[model samples]
Target: MQPLQNAGYDRAITVFSPDGRLFQVEYAREAVKRGTTSLGVKSDEGIVLVVDKRTSSKLVETKSIEKIFQIDDHIGAATSGLVADARSLIERARIESQVYKITYNEPIRVDNLAKKICDMKQLYTQNGGVRPFGSALIIGGIFEGESKLFETDPSGALIEYKATAIGSGRSDAMDVFEDKYEEGMSLDAAIDLALDAVYEATEGKTSAESVEIAVIEKDTEKYRKLSQEEVSSYIDQLVEKKSNDEEETESEE
Candidate 1:
């Protein structure tokens, strides 16, 4: 995909497909620039989205960059692939939220924003067969004074989930989550569950590195991204224990 040099275009740009049909393309470079897969978990405290900042051209060699983004004060979005598409969608979501607030005189809730995203996804898919690459969105915030989480797909379908995981290692992560997650858990417990999920997802795989986390709270309009130090401390004990187990296994072998 070619990057458009000029900025400030109000409408979606059209590109011709091999089948001689026209497709609408929005911001296209944001997804390719970043490396990471996005994950989200929601609880009574609010929603948390986690991303591992590792990108690999091949499955073997991984590099790190920031992949999680704060689309608004209350909502956070992350991407796995096609950084440009993710960013563009994020920007669109933000604008949509703003427009909603102005038009309706009320803050745009997570559900509303999610529908807007789904609409955009439908627009992109209908124009052509080409879909956005690895662009899954985890939308979390307080909607109508209650904490909520929603996951949106490339085609704009949205699901309200208690916890959601995406990206390459998501299946493994979900296994861990299903084994440990409980509704109405405390924030600290939720954080621990999230870390364990990441750990399990990356197990026996070298592609996972650097996790970023964020949280939202009920009655609060903003979602807060946790510090690296804070996140590391929670998982440090587990990592040490895993290291010790590995050492023991090696000695036995």
Candidate 2:
């Protein structure tokens, strides 16, 4: 169907318009941009993930809304776009991990787990009347004594990343990552850089209360989401650092 008036394009997933554009697919990608931002950074010791968790209403339970998930002891993920889609994909991943364990008597590698999810997402695009998932995932974990990170979109295209950001404010977050990222960063440095990335993305609009963070470490038993108090403390430290820097600039003047 020619969905947009005066625009010469069909807006169906199964059909490509005259301009060689799939409006539905493009719409899904835009949905990811409109959703909350999620970021991941990979380092020698672990992976750090961050998310903006702003809610529209006060009545909703903030704790019940999960922007990040621990898929297994060694795997965790962050989502940008529809939370429902992300949850379904994550559940599928959990089942796939279990299946692999049952069949092979060993845990699935992080790369393989990411591949399986990407394959599942790709299957939808090839089928008639199916819409690509309106979500993107950044998965990170410790596997085979090393840390790994990956990003995948609704198109089922998956790629490894040293650092990546997605969803709303992604451009700003990427700017921070590009400026700060270094190879072989310690876990602590990664976490701090992740915070800076989040801050750059949500600058002037969000606070610690509306942020979510998690870490998957090589030495840790499982993925861990930072507590609210811990997030608050980190925010405070960042604020203090900024204040000090501004004061130093004034002294220089």
Candidate 3:
């Protein structure tokens, strides 16, 4: 196709170089890793999405910067990477959800919606006219009393995770998920786990002011992004939980 950015491997997204790598897709993945970390956890009761929302500049409209969005009454997404690209994808998802309902007169399944957006992402790679989205989408939703969570990447691969972390410090976040994730966890436990994952990712950089939390509970209303006070309360509770656990460990020792 056109001249690549990296000269050798970085060309069309579909073209694999001699190394058998799609450099453009890798670049998109790297772009995602540069963003503030976002976490998603699914429990029996519901799903939780947590995001570290550090702005680039004081001039940036803090009020306008949101990493989590309500895709439909039942589905929501937490995004990382190019914020604009994520916004476009989120809007597309919203429209797709509406279109699906209008066509079938029923809510689209969470898995189906995830695949639809991912397939749309893959389309850009096949055509030289466009570039893959430099973003990762973590969608969490409840459909028919079952909670589901999924993460999708620039290469259009969709993966389901009981708990998933994307963007910066994902490796650290994953460790937490591996340790704490349990089947049929309560909403509070899932939220605590999500908060702990974010803490690991940010190395404690996150705070009520710099982070946002959202949840889609058993209620039928929709995804609810927590306010500053709500986030602070969660943080406070998490701190207390950790403190109690440590004290118990010391006592046992």
Candidate 4:
């Protein structure tokens, strides 16, 4: 055999070689965990996602900021933590939708778009197992002959819901939602119910200042972020009515 020299040793060493690619393989289990905070509401009009704007290293610091975001014309997204990751994913979804529209000669439906989002989350998890920005997503749109709503988790799992809530105060939110939910409720009634649910969920623990609301409808296929003034006014009226009713009950008693 030829004399073994430094050249043979270098060849034997697997530093930055194509065959060493396996070493770079990332497992999904190694990914970092994301903090969770977010809420979603669905109604006859469409879907709405409400999130607080505050971000903190700890959940205790969540405050009012502006966490709700529009992903595309017909899509809205909200996050509880890791705002940057949530924004990046939203942007990616917008671009993908545009691409699909141009290439496929048709607009992407909500279901297909949700699937795409889940796929992206999977790819992110697979590629070196990056931690997803800890933010849940609520996607709303009209598709398959009906209005649709989808809730997705950081791990890419998704489910359809007629009306659902997620995040820190989701349990309270759901309770309030059920109290007001009526089958085939009118659009206005549905909007009122959604606002009430969000308010009840955040009340006592957080002030109204910490809340943000957005609405999507089947005809518009767009998310409209409600003005702070508008939301406050609506809530104020509801609170007044509730107080009045409580007083009336006390008098009767």
Q: Which candidate ranks first by TM-score, i.e. highest?
A: 2
Candidate 3 local lDDT, residue 36: 89
Report the Cα lDDT for residue 50, model 2. 88
Candidate 3 clashes between residue pairs 3 or more apart in a chain or in different chains: none
Q: Give one digit per residue, the lDDT tens place, for model 1 in 93-185.
A: 889988887899877877878888888877775564455433777787877667777877664567987776776667777787788889887
Q: How far is candidate 3 from the true structure (C-alpha RMSD, Å)?
A: 3.3
Ordered by lDDT, highest first, the candidates read 3, 2, 1, 4
Q: lDDT, candidate 3, residue 237?
A: 84
lDDT of 4 by residue, 1-253 (tens): 5233322322322222333321111112122123333566666667666654434444554433557777667777666545566677788888888998899977788888888988887564445324444455677765533677787766577898766766656777678766767767655666566666666665633334666777777667776888878767766766776678889999999
Off by over 4 Å in 4: 1-37, 54-64, 205-208
Taking every candidate in turn, the Cα RMSD to the unseen true structure, in Å, is: 7.9, 2.4, 3.3, 10.1
Error of 3 at 29 (Å): 0.3
lDDT of 3 by residue, 1-253 (tens): 6455536656443577765777788889999999989999998889999888888787886667899999999999999999999999999999999999999999999999999999999987778768889999999998988898999999999999999999987999999999889998998899889999988788866667777888898767368878888889999887787779889999999
TM-score of model number 1: 0.74
Top candidate, metric lDDT: 3
Residue 165, candidate 2: how far off, in angstroms? 0.6
Q: After superposition, how far is residue 67 of candidate 2 from its true place, in Å?
A: 0.8
The candidate with the higher lDDT, 3 or 4, is 3
For candidate 4, what is the TM-score? Answer: 0.72
Question: Stretches of candidate 2 above 4 Å error?
Answer: 1-12
